[model samples]
Target: MPDCIICHLEITDPNNLFECPNNHPVHKECLIEWLQHSPNCPLCNEPYSLETKSNLKSDLDKREEEKKKSEEDEARKERNNQIKIIAEKIIFLKFLNMIETLIEKKDFEGALDRLNSIDENKLETVKK
Candidate 1:
């Protein structure tokens, strides 16, 4: 039985086909209708164009590289943020110790002067 040129559907009366050496029947009406201008098969995947393969591979590689770079950037930013938080804590503790020493020496004025230079959260350390 003759089949469609593109999809291999059974050829009806209005449809006619030409035989290809690959044994896949191709309808004349279907040939004119579809797959003639197109490159790939409708059902079975077969490489019809070399340029399509090349472009697809190149595009995929670029996308993968971009994804990797994005992940690395996120990791780096997290590490930097962690380091900054630790440094801020260390600086706050040192400032608090200095304020405690000043206040113990009955240098409340000096300590208050330092407190005025510092922010409220830093002053909260002395209050604690």
Candidate 2:
């Protein structure tokens, strides 16, 4: 197997290999990375075609867009989780206020029932 000129590593996967116009071998990923900075073959210094550069740029742009999209998705999910936590806190506080009101009215039994209905396990899990 031919070794990649850029990484100096053996090209084992056929799909991960590429060749320059001068028949110089390189890894597809390595060539793409190198093409971002330079347009010549690393081994022979042969000038690459405009088509090759354009294709590489398109691939790189696509990857960048995908990465940005993934990051945005993660951020949205995190925001949703935070919103859920805030909403739960609001509900918990409302329940506490109700219990407090019951206590102030001297309704101990109603306050106890409301307190007992809260899931202590869920509360502990959320705290941690």
Candidate 3:
């Protein structure tokens, strides 16, 4: 029923609760965020135990690694999307040039047939 000193909120989950050596209550999540900025307990300003600091540091490192991997995945997806867009544009341009060549040869029906064969969704994406 004790409130976490870091967040000023009641500790509802015993499993996620942590206490300083002075018995000051804090939420585990709150302590992790706090530890990034400060090493000492917010309420008592006392240094946390070496084991506690080590565990927190390991958790923080894992969080950082996960975040970096997520960012890299997102960047790779964006790059692939850009490549897809470029490839689509190349295909569309080539189709258009082929149609132009047909028009120059007075093959109006061939040009119209080629235009009609295109997917509407591809046309919409190019328009956007």
Candidate 4:
């Protein structure tokens, strides 16, 4: 991230970068080389990474947020699917009613043909 810590060049890559506690970014490899000689910051010579507080609350909060988002997305998908199924059921019922009315008018063959193409589960669902 520190393309040029002194001159400020274009930072094109971040994989080989590390930020000190003061937010001064440096190349990880270069930092390693510098640390071999002194356990201080490259820019200000301040002690770096001396404190290692294992605060996992932020990580837990991030995981919880991701889980909540996933749950919401799943619920939205399920609701959309339910709406689609209900719409299909309504269409199925309308078609079936049309066939029944046709049968009542004594158009037996046409009614039977239409009924044969009806979704059986949709009829059962509407019946319930």
Candidate 5:
């Protein structure tokens, strides 16, 4: 059994085997990953054919697009969370200001009523 030079693992599947111009064998998956870093073979330093490089380049491009999309999604979620937190804080501050105005007017009953109507869950989110 021939071993893939890139992974030092046995080429279990003949269909998954790839060879460089010098006939150095490597796993197709490993070579695809390796191509991202270099265009040359790991063993012989020979460049892969244009067709092989083009196919591998296409695969690498798809992987990069997927990675970028995933990162963008994560960033958008983080931004939304930050926006939500800011909105909550703004609401909480407005609620506090209203209470303060009531206290200044000697309207203790109104302030107490407003405090009672406060949503505890929303207050907890602001606290965090």
Candidate 6:
């Protein structure tokens, strides 16, 4: 059994193994992490082929795109929440203005009716 250059451990797991073009074997996980930093073999310092390098770039690019997409989704959700909060505030302010106008007109009964129609649960949902 040959030792993995990255981990300095003997490669025991056949399934978790990889080999360079020069036939030098290393742990699969170690080689992948190493490839992220450098394109050369860890022990022999032999550079990987264009095909291998291209594949690595593709994988990295895919991961970056996914990260950006996730971030955009989170930002969109936050913006929507903010918009909802502002809308709720606008609604509350409009209702208050209506109640004030009713009071000014001495329509206490109409103001009380509007106040009673407001749902407490809806207010709690807007707070969150």
Winning candidate number (lDDT)? 5
In model 6, state the lDDT of residue 75. Answer: 100
Local accuracy of candidate 5 as per-residue lDDT tens digits, 53-119 = 7757777787778878999999999999999889988988998999999999999999999999978
Model 2: per-residue Cα lDDT at residue 19: 81
Cα lDDT tens digits, model 4, 1-128, are: 34745335645577655556777776554555455456677688776674411222354456557778999999999999899778877887788789889988999999888878767876777555
**What is candidate 6's CA lDDT for residue 5?**
75
Model 4 accuracy (lDDT, Cα): 0.66
**Which candidate do you rate higher for lDDT, 1 or 4?**
4
Tens digits of per-residue lDDT, candidate 2, 10-86, equal 99998887787887888878877787667888878888777766757877677668878999999999999998888
lDDT of each: 0.63, 0.82, 0.86, 0.66, 0.88, 0.81
The residue-by-residue lDDT of candidate 3 on 109-128, one tens digit each, is 99999999989998888755
Per-prediction TM-score: 0.46, 0.66, 0.69, 0.44, 0.70, 0.60
Off by over 4 Å in 5: 1-10, 19-26, 34-52
Ranked by lDDT from best down, the candidates are 5, 3, 2, 6, 4, 1
C-alpha-based local distance difference test score of model 2: 0.82
Rank by TM-score (best first): 5, 3, 2, 6, 1, 4
Best by TM-score: 5
Candidate 6 per-residue C-alpha lDDT over 1-128 given as tens digits, one digit per residue, 9 for 90 to 100:
88887898999988776677887887866776788677899778898777765756766566667778999999999999899889988877788899999999999999999989989997677556
- How many backbone clashes are present in model 3? 0
Reference-based TM-score, model 4 = 0.44
